[model samples]
Target: MDELVRWLGVQLDADKARAAQWHDLECSIHEHQEGGLLKAVAALEVYGEVPGAVCDCGGPARVLREIDAGRQLLALHLPTPYQDEGDRWPGCTTCSWRDEMDDLQVRYPCKTVRLLALPYADRPGYREEWRP
Candidate 1:
């Protein structure tokens, strides 16, 4: 559990960093005087926003919010190093939706708590492999 939580935190940081880098690259390309101009404009385009998780709809899904599953909430409040890992269950709401008949469809994490919960290094970027 602890390992999973730590890995998740690392993943979150990596995701944010990747997003920032992408925005910076885009801004450099457009060379706008005002700040965040590219971000605002790119938000309207597909693949403009950095993907948090793989979505079924083929679009980037964000972490959105942490879903409390029992004791996980308490773990989230823990201090940096001692905090329990893999407490928050991640889900994708962006690509998930209900059908005309109201049948809801959603995507779950690709692996179980024990597997994905294991500690791992942050993935630098899509082009690069995972590193410590």
Candidate 2:
């Protein structure tokens, strides 16, 4: 249970960093500016210390930061993490970030979390949107 909680914490951090792009929320340990899209990490020392994670880009940094800021909450969404890295259990579907798909995040740590954003209008106003 403890292991599950810890990894989930990491996952949540990654997810929240990306979420900060469209929302005014602190997703990291310190305050940072949002980038062109979600999961977009800001410059070094520009906002605060960069997140030390598996990700090597600003995007993942953004997500991690968001988690630290408490903008998004994470729960054990799955029973396991591929291997036996953690314990598997029932009722692991209580994660809040599990069902919400915002159009700002392109991907997540170790996986791709698709969130598409299309231009709106004649000059940034509206046009058409098609999702399948």
Candidate 3:
């Protein structure tokens, strides 16, 4: 298999595991409903700034951008497969704790460059709640 595909598979597995944890703790849902992993991965964003802090891989950290779109924009489009499974994916951004989000974003450029899970207060539910 290609490196990027392999990397994505690993990332997906980790994300799915995280979703299971969240479901057990918060949602009380058991099955791996579609988009569960995506929702969990999207919720891992850090909002504030940190001075003199480098990524786990020793690279400069990328700060969060002002996202005008909804928090669950990515979730709106579920079941979207890898753009080109045959093509090699991009390398990880070299962050700690298996944060290949940047790499995934780069690989799927058409999705959205700005990734931030801002609080959608006015709404009555979480992004995953409205999965269609």
lDDT of each: 0.35, 0.34, 0.29
* lDDT score for candidate 2 against the true structure: 0.34
Tens digit per residue, CA lDDT, model 1, 1-132: 243445566665655555544422233222222454533323224335565422232121222232223125424333233212443433322334456975444322222332333333334321112211
**Model 1 accuracy (lDDT, Cα):** 0.35
- Highest lDDT, which number? 1
Candidate 3, position 129, lDDT? 25
- Compare candidates 1 and 3 on TM-score and give the better one: 1
Q: Alpha-carbon error at 98 in model 1, in Å?
A: 36
Question: Which ranking of candidates, highest lDDT first?
Answer: 1, 2, 3
Look at candidate 1 and give me any clashing residue pairs: 4-86, 4-117, 5-85, 5-86
Q: After superposition, how far is residue 36 of candidate 1 from its true place, in Å?
A: 29
Give the local distance difference test score of model 3. Answer: 0.29
